[model samples]
Target: MAIELKDLAPLLLKAERTNGDVDPSVLTNVLRGGRVANDRRKELLQVIERHPVLSDRDMMYRNHDERYNFGIKKAFHYIKLLQEGGYTDPVDQQILYSAMGEPTAIEVHRSMFVPTLENQGDDKQRAKWLPLAKNYKILGAYAQTELGHGSNVQV
Candidate 1:
């Protein structure tokens, strides 16, 4: 008799977990930096998973425009949650976003644009732009064009 597809997945997962001599938690902690960091990540994930807007269900069925709109909604809600939760640490924010699975449009603003301002901008520029960028009052984009390289921007 053949196993059902639904049954096969659980059986395989259970077998894999039970058969492994190495403890899964230990490996997870190492990857996450430590047990404390892993715990923090789990806490953040719980918050994200409990939110309806962040759910990945039906995402594959969405058209490009729908997906884009949905992503913006998720990003907005996620940012609000971060502020309400008092999560100012970049690492914590990154972990929470990673749990969301898909990259949202604001990701470029958070990951690239914000960092560039902090690192490269003068004090006056940082003072002027950081607040607006961080608060999402203005969204930022980075564009790089290499001459004679067509659309490829990579060096």
Candidate 2:
């Protein structure tokens, strides 16, 4: 599978990175921020990989609605697995989102909702809303693209 590197990637990345410097695990740990972070990421990836539902394979042949709905199912199981495994950090949540490959329907929760609360909402507001947001109780979407400058989507 790696045969399509086109020779430029090796030069750009250098042979040392591919086969020298330090152990690959060590490099992965360092790149992932630390040992604990690396282990958590590995655990999450393993959880995704071992399960058939979480795999991204065979998605090419499915219809849009099929894929979308399957992705939603996967997202639900994805969170359940992580939470059940004792993961609480928001950073760990990115593992499932990363595997999603593109912007899914739940993109707003991660991109806009969390940032909006963290940046603007006071502690009381966050305390009341963040749990629901975190647990997917209130799935929000950024619908700004659907609203023109004059439109009032608030209602």
Candidate 3:
């Protein structure tokens, strides 16, 4: 099944809990890729000093429009850095997405399917089982409903 944005919101909250909100220093590192020298740090601050706020979508949009494109640009920058750093495997991408909460759907896939396979499938079974998951050949969902033997959902 295709994933929906509504289905992924909780995972984003979980991600913030799991990874903390995005760090300003991490953005600096993404731009410069090393410890900022004293002069560079001042320059960075000077750049921000003129703006009342910082935004994540500066790469894609004409200006800082947070709602539509924050994750898009941030994910773009992240994937570029990861490719530069030579971690190109799909599993590596999954892990990075799980850690950083972007490309919007990978975290939902991980939170739903990864542990489900590990806990609900057998050992040799899981080896064969996980390939589909890693490749997006299979899709999964996490549902809470007021039905069956499970507890109720208010909504």
Top-TM-score candidate index: 1
Quote model 3's TM-score. Answer: 0.35
> Which pairs in model 2 have colliding backbones?
none
- Worst lDDT 10-window in candidate 2: 96-105
Model 3 worst lDDT window (10 residues) = 48-57
Candidate 2 versus the native: TM-score? 0.69
lDDT string for model 2 (1-155, tens) is 36566867768678657776688788888998999988878777776677777666666788999988876777776667666776667777788667655555667777898788777889999998888887777866665474667756675
Tens-digit lDDT string for candidate 1 (5-36)? 89889889999988989988899899988999
Clashing residue pairs in all predictions, respectively, total 0, 0, 0
Give me the runs in candidate 2 sitting further than 4 Å from their true place: 1-23, 100-103, 145-155
lDDT of 3 at 118: 73
Model 3 off-target regions past 4 Å? 1-95, 98-103, 147-155
lDDT of each: 0.86, 0.74, 0.55
Alpha carbon lDDT at 34, candidate 1: 97
